[model samples]
Target: MSIEQRIHAHYAGLSPQERRAADLILDHIDDLALYSSAELAEMSGVSRATLSRLYRHLGFGSFTELRETARTLRQQGVPLGPDGDPELSQHLDQELRNLRKVLDPAGDDRTARAVSDLAGARTVLVVGLRNSHPVALHLKQQLQQAREGVRLAPLPGQTLGEELVDVGPGDVVVLLGFRRRPSGFERLVSFCAQTGARTLLIADGTARRHASSVDLWIECPLGSVGPFDSYAAAMSLVAVLADGVLAAAGEDGRRRVSRTAEVYAELDELDLR
Candidate 1:
């Protein structure tokens, strides 16, 4: 197993100091991988000697191996945090860190573009099965606020394709899928291609089987909690995407969110009579 995989496997079981070491490595991934143990230890307010012990405990022969691993991860363009390298923990410092990276100025353009597409699209249909459903629903809520003409599929009797077929050339279909891959989602994407609809796939990595059907992609880390995956980063991405749509909507966006509240409140206040 990779150092990261090992770290995660035993993450919860790690003592405070060991976690401190892991946190340090996680906090400054590129730097740690690029520098020596002494350099990395200094950054974490810890001692080099202590870091050396931690490295050995994790089964690395030397700091050189650790550095090599970090370098390899860097080349892979993988972000080091809870999503890419999660540990079993109640807190989600990694997600906040990852969110900051995603919200970086460089990443804002893509967010803006995605939002604009949703706002302008004739229809917006979403797909997410398994753990991705929450993220998909969050997007649906935000887009409902960002602008109208949004829909979520696989609800009630409607299948994902049932919604996919309805999107015309200017419409958008956002599919949320990841991990171990799903052939059925890919086929659904293929069906979307036959339609005139524009497509977007929000995924976790460079894997592109389902990415082929979409015109754009948003990649984020999939955080996990124990056997369960963390959807924090995915939710954050949904937030960012929604912000973009809200930006595009101007006054109309504000009104939509406000109106949604009014309607929901009315529903809640009613006796169902």
Candidate 2:
């Protein structure tokens, strides 16, 4: 595992002081090579002793060792947050690369497989929390129009376990796992697998480490030119996936769309002004 993976894996077990120190390291990863243990400890509001212990807890002998590892990661262009002044042009370049990566042949193949699974499944469950909610909701709406039994994870104050109790063969679960995810993400994936549901993850590269858990993952780069991570790639992926689902659904999709239109017309939901 990489340093980032190690940190993420052990994050939940970290002490309060260790977590604060870890956040500082993750936020300023590019500069980790520059700061001394004392300086880092001061920045994180912890003692130097605590800082030393933090490295050991993360499986390093010393802070210097950890810094050296971080330096190597920086050299490899592992995203280490914003390093300098952000420019619109730089941001646009990164977003363009992200979009291209998603449309590449390998990415297209993965997307096609996900769409095929969804198109043939008896139930499609779209899930996302926090910033991912919009994408999940949008996917559910599109899939509802394309097929039957498509819905977002229900929200009647039910635990995930309760909601998934009936999920078995022929069910598809799509999870949107962007940065700053909820605590129960891995649990959700694991539970779905245990219930015999095929799982697909649309997420940032942060999820690459969890690849073995899901049937397929569409990684949308979240690099940014500003304070916030960009979502242009993710949005593009959503559109492509929806298109793939429609194509795979074929005549069944057309019939579902017609049914949906009939219901909308009967309910007077459309204002054709």
Candidate 3:
């Protein structure tokens, strides 16, 4: 049974003090991962004995077992309410884990395949709506220099239908799908799929349930590291994938990039000062 089920099953029978400790745990479960048993007891206004009893009631062999479970759940993308000034070390550790997950050997192989698909496409459209628009724009900017037919979807003041009119075979679409995805986002992907465009979705684990909407689903570690979901992992994936795409583009890509650089230099668009 899940930890929650165990807690609920034995909740009513817990002593009043034990119930108080239980309530404290449920209210701030995320904090438990970083708190010692004695610290948690003090913060919850309960004695160490009360915490021990609560853990026993919840069927945990020891307080350490409960804490370890909390850590595992959080790492698995479980919601832990709003982050509250976590230690800098913890944040760094989490980000390191996130990066490792994305850049591992298996992930590298998948990214290589994605790069191959993108490099062979006639046109690539990047779609980022709401909070994802900036990332999409960044991708488009980077890709435009490397390849000729990169476009950002839903151009300024235009609807998707108008933008996708020319979308068909030999096209690739990269989509950013973070939490609280915009309404109709799934339908938009479905429409792209029907038009024979290969759609790659960059999102969190939550996107697994909606797998059929896109041809490729790259899970980026996303969570509320602070007030918003940290995109460090997603951005790192983008950077690496961008490199992969450029590598696949080879000599032709280099030539296009050289031309773009010449144009930028002529216009003096860069600031070296």
Name the lDDT of candidate 1. Answer: 0.71
- CA shift at 246, candidate 3, in angstroms? 1.5
Clashing pairs in 3: none
Screening candidate 2 with a backbone cut-off below 3 angstroms (N, C-alpha, C), the clashing residue pairs are none
Clashing pairs in 1: 223-230, 224-230
- TM of each candidate vs. truth: 0.61, 0.68, 0.71
Which tens-of-lDDT digit does each residue in 1-273 have in candidate 1? 777677777778766777898887766654455466776776667777777777887778888988888656643444433333335354467566556665677554766677777878988988777556777888897788778788887787766656665677888888787554455766777777677787778876634556656777777765433234456777878887888888888998888878877887878964555
lDDT of 2 by residue, 1-273 (tens): 667777898899889999999999887776577788888888999988877877888899998789889766643335554567778788889889888887787545887788789888989988888778888888888778888898786555755655677788889988888777787888877877777889888887777876789888888777665556677888777777788888888998888888888999999999978
TM-score rank, highest first? Answer: 3, 2, 1
**What RMSD value applies to candidate 3?**
5.9
Off by over 4 Å in 3: 1-84
Off by over 4 Å in 1: 1-93, 223-227, 269-273
Q: CA lDDT of 137 in candidate 1?
A: 83
